[model samples]
Target: MEWKFVRLLSIGQIRPGMKLGKRIYNEEGLTLLAEGAELTVSIIRRLERLGIDILYIRDEVTDDIVLPEMVADETRREAVKQIRTVYRSMMNDKMGRMSYPHLGYSFRKMTESILDDLGSREDVLIMLGDIHTTDHYLYTHSFNVCLYTLTLGMAAGHSREDLFTLGMGSILHDIGKTRISPKVLLKPGRLTDEEFAEMKRHTELGFALLKDEPFVPLLAAHCAFQHHERLDGSGYPRGIRDGEIHDFAKWIAITDSYDAMTTNRVYRRGMLPHEAVDILYSGSCTQYDQRKLEVFRDKVALYPVGLTVRLSTGQTGVVTSVPPKTPNRPIVRVIEDEEGASVQPYEVDLSRHLSIMVSRIAEN
Candidate 1:
């Protein structure tokens, strides 16, 4: 089989004739453009409007590197569609208590599908940060959070039943945001103190929406309530501290914060995985649980495959693989020399070359 080389490129760097190396999906999870489709001026404009920041493009240097997907594309489409449905209903209803008869049954079924998909994988490292659309941030963010939280739950040796509850809570953790006004919710600048105060209300708002629902689990509702509450009692809605919060909420909090930081938003560009992890570590034992942070750091691909990075030795390469035990050290395939010249590509295993380091992400 012939292997295609693919490079991750920001949308601004992509040219009109460049072939898309990956399929583009809309907010509904329907295919907006199939893989190998040619980009055009109008399509590019539309994608920019949708707030898509990055895309995979065919390249000649990086070879035989295929990105991993934790769930089937069909499963993701259905999950996103379901999330959009439920969240939209909650956002549109003035009473905030629309009696959706299938709420519990539907979500439970979706959770099972996600778990089953996750079970089939041997190693799961989140690579979903590569593609994001700010307009659809809530829906995709919910789904991504669920995936990350469930992965952490499984790593922590949770039972299947426990996993189900965790998944539900993580997926709906931000349901309260549905009630916030779009003006404040999607603001492109730093929020004022008044706006942030209103934003903090999502926790209570989420709890109020989920607590009385017939099929929604009480623990799941609390997960929404307490996911923002820090270990140091600095979190809002109740100022709850460690042991005061449930274990499930704690797990959701770690993944929730990770996803929010790594994902692109209208207000700012997303941080790289390593950078986000650093911030998480900075808050360890104060804002976050210590042991759980270790588990999450190990599972993450700090430098994901296809990311262009610069080495301290002044070479440039795309990450080929991240070692499971040493996520910080990845195998990189160098394609350029220090002088910004193309070279005969070769691989460098950072774990073996302990003296060398990845300096930073290569500039466009």
Candidate 2:
């Protein structure tokens, strides 16, 4: 039988001539390298310089696992293009009074496209395998937040119009960051108290930028404004508690934190999905809405396909599939024996094998 798996490797584990299993995109959402392209030393160096440390590769043991796309490439590319254009324009016009000619229409259409794409999927899970450069982290992050927010909104039985509003708010939630200095915004290390205070101003600045815009909805502006607010009033800006916070902003808050923790940055590696979820749960009913957090956790693929994991039985395997109903328990294809010997591969469905458990993610 043909084994279906994809290997996730770090830059240090990659070598010349390995075929790429996924497409890499540039800041403009353009394809930097096509899928199945051979990697060379020079190519690897260039990717490293671009701050890409992880990649998915096809090999003898992992060749046929076709990961599903939550949104089409074209849709994501166009949305990123729009985000870059609008954000850069706002940054250049520091006065924040200039009008964007088609800001409202463009984002409305993009939100609709995302909703449609997500609706078409039989089972949607938040998978984190997309390739992007560090320089364009904001734009990519905006798109991802929008995806996660909308998915949760749909799961909560939100109306179509509500989903559009949530999408718009999530996508442009960080528009205020464009006004912040790159030095502080892109600092490679932890920010000092003073610097952090300055960074926190983005919420108010974003509100000022969007509140009066002709095309932007007032609720959407509040999403940017209050997304940082926590349940117990420890958050920023207004320091509002549960009822004071808008439902939309509360939703955005969960997605924003989840994505931030799970995405790579200049300073640190991204945490695995399960790790991030654990942090989220720790803040339940205090920092986040417990009901919303539970919904978000259910929609995330804790052990995404292509990830390497170790089972409690001391066997190692590559994740092949994740059932939406039981995302925590994925189907793993064992490739190594407990004694560290190479063995004929076999499939293990953790949902059925109740005695077996995923001990940890392998570091390979």
Candidate 3:
């Protein structure tokens, strides 16, 4: 039977035979339970041991609520795996056991998989920073940048062929970092001017590596070369001015910055999606192409569904739906009062109440 609503409950409140309304993921983004899995005594104990205190459950009262997934779990996992494959192949080639042809083929296959999984979707407002493990940061960030770049390109009315090139470029744009020393890449503190200069060479290095490879276009190479270039010529490498940057490079720069800001790194905690968007907007024209950045704002979910938030009125709720016109102001299902007491659930459409702004992300 299809459940019409979903409810969030404490781990103690979950009983055996209750079906999971949403997939439960650990802090590392590993799935613990999939939707529709009927909880048993052991499963409940397992979740408790893992310190999970809250989850979405399918039940009679909350059966009317439905939470939409940002992307298919299978598709995201496959993309990450393929990205890992490509990175490893590149590493092998760097070690002089070259396989240019195989590497090129793998890049093409990964791009095609990306298209098949995400291209036909109506919207691409996904959570890009979900998979965050220190060791696999490169692979995870590459996949996210690729996804975000593809979405921005599509929004600009780019053709599929153009998106194919854009996607490939965005994924491999940071490949040159592999050549840098781990001492610099993994450093927790600020880098010295010398170390910073060395870090900046990734752009040139990436361009040189991919420039003449078979099946890789010159445009893709430029994407690696120029993604760092800013509109005012303040960026690294060539420091080229506004009109000199390639269209693909310009778009990738915006997505790269967005993903980088919203992702947790060893040095600092990640910003929320809306917070990152605000920073991007502040940098428009000087650090990014303002025209492209505008399109980016429209496509991303500033207040993504399933996020718990506190309103200015002191009510807390889970985001229910993003109104079409105002992506920032969403309809929230308020479940708690100002003092943290559980209350009767009700919907609050932020778009309707101009004074009720979202305060911050609330803990589940």
Task: Give per-residue CA lDDT, model 2, range 297-362, as digits (tens).
Answer: 888999878888899999999898888888889999898988878789888999999899999988
Q: Name the 10 consecutive residues with the lowest summed lDDT in model 1.
A: 1-10
Pairs of colliding residues, candidate 1: none
- Displacement of residue 304 (Cα, Å) in model 2 is 1.2
Measured against the true structure, the TM-scores of the candidates, in listed sequence, are: 0.93, 0.94, 0.80
Runs with alpha carbons beyond 4 Å of true place in candidate 3 = 1-67, 92-99, 188-190, 338-340, 352-355
Superposed model 1: Cα runs more than 4 Å off? 1-5, 186-189
Q: Which of candidates 1 and 3 is the stronger one according to lDDT?
A: 1
Q: Residues 205-228, candidate 3: write the lDDT tens digits.
A: 888878888888779989999999
- Residues 141-241, model 1: lDDT tens digits: 88989999999999889999999999999998998899898888878778999999999999998888788777788999999999999999999889999
Against the correct fold, how does model 2 do in TM-score?
0.94
Model 1: residue 46 alpha-carbon error in angstroms: 4.1
Cα error, candidate 3, residue 186 (Å): 3.7
Alpha-carbon runs more than 4 Å astray in model 2: 1-5
The most accurate candidate by TM-score is 2
